[model samples]
Target: MVRQETDVTLRRCTECRGYAYGGGPACAVCRDLVDGLVEGAWAVFLRQWDTVAGGDQERALAEMVAAEPDRHDWRIVDAAFDRLVCPDCGGRLARGPVGCPACDLAHGFRYAAIETDRPGVPPGNEHAIRVNVSVVRRPQVTSESEVLVRRLLLPLLLAGFLPTTEAAQRMSALMKKSPPGRRAQLVEQAVEGLAEEFSRTRRAARAAASSPTSPDTPAATRHRSARGRPR
Candidate 1:
């Protein structure tokens, strides 16, 4: 069995307006922000993903990693096998210990061993009507492609060209809804969506870096260090 990284929360750093977890201070990128600027969102924490081993997605990532571990610069990326989302906003969702009340909102049914009371049956018959119900989460019911586009593609586009498990979900969703002849169209759309964001982020930094007059490069222009701070 492969060991896994200690789980961490996913919080949005106020300074950088980027996601950060693995607590301490606001990540390096946003350290300049005042303390407590880092805000945590359960939805983000739950839906956000990271690379892991021995879970369902491990086999798939392992195959790719073994085939070309060197092809990618990073040792790991998000490899999520499961997907969940917020029912209200369709924003990336996080999971938490669910109480009876909360469970009703998140799941269409409740996981419970229920005893049935029959109107016509005598009281003694109630014992025979016990049942177990497996409640599933309320589905978004949107096309998989739409989920992929919003959860994965949108973030990459806005924040730059980073890829994560959310992107994979988006792509998988697209594969399901795409028409037979137009499948490539969905793929290209995903790429284009990512590219658009990458372009903007790169351009902002480029312009700042190239300018000779600026006394200090803007925070957004600098590259993030391993700890998420600007170098």
Candidate 2:
């Protein structure tokens, strides 16, 4: 009888408790799932594992983490930190690739990495910043309603040029407090004054062209325009 070689699929990391895909020595899923949610992510995974696999799995996970605290990479803060809380389900996400399959099908994580110029620097000099991010399953935008609404409303909201209801009322009150003329009447008066000045300028220019060239033409009648216009 000839001995034949048997093909076998290797399991995922037994220590990290990842599903086996027969690709690597460690949990390939865990290694690949670098969304940046440091230790809190591992805690969530362990907690879930504990709930599903019972006390034994929990003990194993605890021991593994205790041996290597950096596995989770979650900074143990003295105070409560701001976490992404689901508005619909009120489920808290632990910074990395995670999802509630019941509420959502997306499995994602969030985390930060130290991309240092000098990796061998001392702890004091190692510059690292916490960057928060989200990775979600792409959702379909079925309508152009959002774009339409934004385009219509954004201009009105910005640049205090247009009067809102309250603003209109305020302006009305201010005009009422002013002495004598109505706002429209005042605007009309200003317009009439501008028309008169423009007519006078044209008449003067015509007269100057018809008349002989003089040494002084009284500097072309230096009449000003209006407020918000150059003098």
Candidate 3:
């Protein structure tokens, strides 16, 4: 059989755990789903957070974060997303095509080379069966996304707006929440708060380091400066 020779790759959705197969961006359905989530993200986040945090939302959230400082991931709750279906075979695509029946059928070679006997062949004939190699192409979006996010985080890390790289990561992941106007305001407030705290810590450290040293530091400095009573 002649191969189609079309190059395509599959992408996996992070939020919905769905799969989309194509050459460029993900399928239209997935884009629409994530776009909807991004449009009214702040409200959605608050609603989801409130439900997840139960009573006394702020306190609950604080306690939860304190329990696991590096584990407060955003979750899209109370919604179901449809998995992407392959355009060619009308079958659901798998995330990166591991053990996917449709993917195996569409792109997997599914066979190994083997020797077979032919009718009327010589007594010791050892001919091998012809085999075709098929490679399933998977999207490289994850690594690309990581590099892009790292580039975006560099400025925040240098500017002291974010105290650590991990915090920058979390903030970047949650960037869709605040709208443009609100995003600017929130960023300003956050930077101001962090800057103030950083400045305060530095001042405290300097004061502690420069504090009096048993009333001997000044005397030693003077003795060193004197010329032994002009002798």
Alpha carbon lDDT of each predicted model: 0.35, 0.31, 0.34
Model 2 residue 122 CA deviation in Å: 7.1
Q: Between 1 and 3, whose TM-score is larger?
A: 1
lDDT of 2 by residue, 1-231 (tens): 111121212223355542222111133443333222234444556565554334555545544533343333323210011223344456442322234442242111222322222232223221121211111111112122222222222112111112245643654464455454454344334333433454465467658765534334445753446689964
Superposition error at 117 for model 3 (Å): 71
Identify the runs in model 3 with alpha carbons over 4 angstroms from their true place: 1-162, 213-231
Whose lDDT is greatest here? 1
Q: Estimated TM-score per prediction?
A: 0.26, 0.17, 0.24
Considering summed lDDT, which 10 consecutive residues are worst modelled in model 1? 129-138
Residue 75 of model 3: what lDDT? 18
**Model 3 global lDDT (CA atoms, 0 to 1):** 0.34
Which is the better candidate, 1 or 3, if ranked by lDDT? Answer: 1
Write the residue-wise lDDT of candidate 1 on 1-231 in tens digits.
111221322335555444331111224442222111111211232234353444556555534533342342111211111133345445322222333333234333211212233342234222221110010111134343433233323223223233556865777777887896887566756666666665676678668767754447676765445686665
Worst ten-residue run, lDDT, model 3? Answer: 128-137
Of 2 and 3, the candidate ranking higher by lDDT: 3
Worst 10 residues of 2 by lDDT: 131-140
